[model samples]
Target: MASYKYDIASGAEAFTFNSVMRACTKEVAALSWCMQHGLIAAKAVCSRCAPPPFMRRKGMHWRCSRSSCRVERSVRMNSFVERSTAPISKLVMVIFFWASGTHVTEAAQHAEVGGDGNVVEIDATSMTKKQKYNRGKKHADY
Candidate 1:
């Protein structure tokens, strides 16, 4: 069984459950967070003939602004969500559910995944990446 933890000491004030839902299910939220936090971006200068723009949403991915570049980047390229095999939506759903007072096991089921797991998500301002990484969160949903 896998376990997850959320850091909700004092700084995790901004992330309401609804916001998390939007981020997980909507490209705009995903892309917005990725770009705002610098999680995904290609070279400002294109490898091709034209200078590619910054990171922009193209369908389900963050691709080079210049459509011709064809450079698609993972939204989780560098953030906490980089390696989990689970769907982003499931991850976010479980985390929010847990924070909203749902039990860990129930949260995982709400995410529609098997096994028992604990999820802990702290506000970006409250905890450091090292702290989050230390809590056994091998993968993130959003």
Candidate 2:
């Protein structure tokens, strides 16, 4: 598997939609990409065991390496997408769209917002800004 380093400083100008799509075409690839981008942790320690066993990748979850302690932890734990149920690919696309300043509706469409009975609700209230300290147009007397 190839490795990828996504520099946020470079911005969207460094990557095209096709490139991002190709990089995250598979679940493993997407996970790897997220790891490279620091969006996910590559290693985890099992909290259930004393002396903390190292966790190994077991499908979508991490399993404790100790034979006696078979504890499991989500790969997304403490990551940027921890609460998100969306597929890694879709999430990556959404991130790309957001970083590129694409319109919310268009970004949602491109990212295929929801799937398999999953619902994605977006709050755009923060997207609009209020004039700070009433700095914009002032009210005039009639």
Candidate 3:
């Protein structure tokens, strides 16, 4: 697994079972095992208990070796419900906003992608050569 000893031993308040479960896939057996063995808490009562394979690094990316019956998944894949569509940067922004104690409306305002207070539509034909150049950073110098 991704040896989360850093989180466990950080000396601040440690993650609870609920938080760990939030980061895990809905693999009931593994979740139950974590709860029963106290791996959900810092200073696990059973640290030697094997972690699921998906948490382990096989190469540049982590993946499970079990093809017959998959029981594990990466934290990223497990943590978010709609990970494919949303950009990772946006997800980080949400986490950052949550941690910083900012209200959701302010965060949404800061991360605006579409129009202003009123909808400002754009068209491909309206984009001038200069605008396109600026958009592409064509004037950038090394």
Candidate 4:
């Protein structure tokens, strides 16, 4: 028997790679989805306050609602998105492809070959024209 560090499914999201990828198609959607997955921080804190506390959002960015200390916080503060330059949709699509049992190299290839890298298109085709995706393990070249 082998020991595993993680389960096949994270929670209620059974076989949810497709759904998660779909959810991250937009900026706001990506933020919310990442927050739900614990991949990014959803809330912000006031920096001007003496003790510093959680802040409320005025719009796209968070702001200290207190009239005396109305400091604004960038949406990317302390979040993974702050450092990443890649498009959120591409990241989500790659993650989905990876979670769906596709290798990183294969995922890249799939993305290039299949516009937007949707799972259906990626899964529907194979790298080599000779070896079909679902037919067998032996590659055509081998």
Candidate 5:
């Protein structure tokens, strides 16, 4: 299996291509090359449309090469990041702050994507309202 080096936290570190991509710039190309060369093993398959692919290397890193999948598309094209504008280095820094439990506003401030890259402000109130609505629905069903 292919191997990678990444510093993980004490608790569960969510395994995703984004994390691996955040870890190293070469991880993506390395994993993709590994998959092509049949050097890695598949763990869990994605349940989303087009079924995104996932490869695990000792549970420390992950890669998704499903080019036609939504997750890849979301990471590559959507979200607050542009598809080709921001540098991966800056994105990794943003991910680091996010992993450190910094709030979106604070992270956005640190990202500095507003001036050069398109930075979307996350509305905390909207998220709270959505959570409240979900809770109300669950209670009503009971």
Candidate 6:
């Protein structure tokens, strides 16, 4: 399991959902929250440079500190949100809603996946199944 900054043992009820929602309202705040929650790397190393120079945040990307190397990478690189096309705020809200066991339609509405007229169908059977006896792989070995 991933290490969360908050005490997840207390369950989703104890999670400060409102505070998280507020924090994620802005791009910068969402970035900060993601970093704090280990969703994004706070610091990154440049792969192009030998001995890997530390990368610093420059706008939406991380630039290498070494003047000679000058490598650049997206802030979302190697993170859960890396491939996501949605805004960070929406993604954060969706994740929180899912964690809190909110209904699929409610979560989708909150995340803005579908507008007032659009339909969002959720097939629960398509979701990953629980491991049986914790002995087999979660997915079928095809």
Clashing pairs in 1: 4-118, 4-119, 5-120, 6-120, 6-121
How accurate locally is residue 69 in candidate 3, as Cα lDDT from 0 to 100? 38
lDDT of 6 by residue, 51-120 (tens): 8878999978999999988888999899999999877877888788878789998776556676878888
Each prediction's whole-model lDDT (CA): 0.57, 0.80, 0.43, 0.67, 0.47, 0.80
lDDT, candidate 1, 14-132, per-residue tens: 46665665676764565564455454453243344444457665555566666466677665666556787666556566656866898877665555454447555655553423436
lDDT tens readout by residue for model 2, 14-121? 368877877678888888877876789988999988888789999999999999888888898998889999888778887888887999887766666586687878
Better of 1 and 4 by TM-score: 4
lDDT of 6: 0.80
TM-score result, candidate 3: 0.27
Sliding window of 10 residues with minimal summed lDDT for model 3 = 40-49
Clashes of 4: 0
- After superposition on all C-alphas, the RMSD of every candidate to the true structure, in Å, is 16.7, 11.4, 16.6, 14.8, 13.9, 11.5
Relative to the unseen true structure, what is the C-alpha lDDT of residue 11 in candidate 1, on a scale of 0 to 100? 42
Relative to the unseen true structure, what is the C-alpha lDDT of residue 62 in candidate 1, on a scale of 0 to 100? 65
CA deviation > 4 Å runs, candidate 3: 1-75, 78-84, 117-142
TM-score for every candidate vs. truth?
0.44, 0.63, 0.27, 0.55, 0.23, 0.65
* Candidate 4 residue lDDT tens string, 35-85: 677766677778779787788865447888778888887666686567667
Worst 10 residues of 4 by lDDT: 113-122
Q: Can you write out model 3's per-residue Cα lDDT over 1-142, one digit (the tens) per residue?
A: 5755455556323234334334333444343434344433211111233553333433222344555433333333434423555543455455556776879787776557454565757765534335353466453332
Error of 6 at 25 (Å): 0.7
The residue-level lDDT of candidate 2 at 16 comes to 83
What TM-score quantifies how close candidate 4 is to the native fold? Answer: 0.55
Best by TM-score: 6
Count of clashing pairs, candidate 2: 0
Candidate 2 pairs with clashing backbones: none
